[model samples]
Target: MAEVKSMFRDILSKQLPVEDITTMVLRKPKLLPLKSLTLEKLKKMHQAVQETTHQQEMVEKEQQQITH
Candidate 1:
């Protein structure tokens, strides 16, 4: 419980859109073993998500430029 709440708070603090956070928590509950993860692990996961999102945005931008 406490760990789960802490992970939730950490995710919220990242300033992700509420819909995205909700989807992340609800859509893939099995993917995140929040109860078993350490604080360090949670931070790493957050960083990875951010990096992946950035990469996705860059890819979309490149695709748009190519099409234009």
Candidate 2:
């Protein structure tokens, strides 16, 4: 997670555009945080967050590669 955050920082430092990042990070359908979410629902939300974070890292990596 820290590595992904650092990669995102690196991408922004290199002036990669934010639109792509936002799309990659936010386009996924997030699980609703219901007060009564079952254990499975909680797990799905965690999975979604992990996947979203991974996608952001991938986008940042691609952008950095292009800039270099």
Candidate 3:
């Protein structure tokens, strides 16, 4: 009985953790940016050019209508 009890205690002690404590720090998540800075700037420039061209075309159409 003594040998069995000791063996059981040993097994239990091995399986159980005593006074094990740890703190976890959760870091704030940042955006995983897909676009490069240069690419974003280029996209903006292209959009501006497209808008300017569209506006110019609308103005030309208006002038042509006024003349005709």
What TM-score would each prediction reach against the true structure?
0.45, 0.45, 0.55
lDDT of 1 at 64: 100
Report residue 5 deviation for candidate 2 (angstroms).
Answer: 81
Top candidate on lDDT is 3
RMSD of 3: 8.0
After superposition, candidate 1 runs with Cα above 4 Å error: 1-37
Q: How far does residue 3 in candidate 2 sit from its true spot (Å)?
A: 87
TM-score of 1: 0.45
> At residue 24, what lDDT does model 2 achieve?
44
1-68, model 1: which lDDT tens digit per residue? 99999999998788866786566333644576546558778889999999999999999999999999
Name model 3 segments beyond 4 Å from true.
1-30
Per-residue CA lDDT of model 2 for 1-68, tens digit only, reads 99999999998788956775676444778797656658778899999999999999999999999999
Residue 13 CA displacement from its true place in model 3, Å: 26
List per-candidate RMSD values in Å: 25.9, 32.8, 8.0
Query: Which pairs clash in the backbone of model 2?
Result: none
Give the local distance difference test score of model 2. 0.87
The residue pairs in collision within model 1 are none
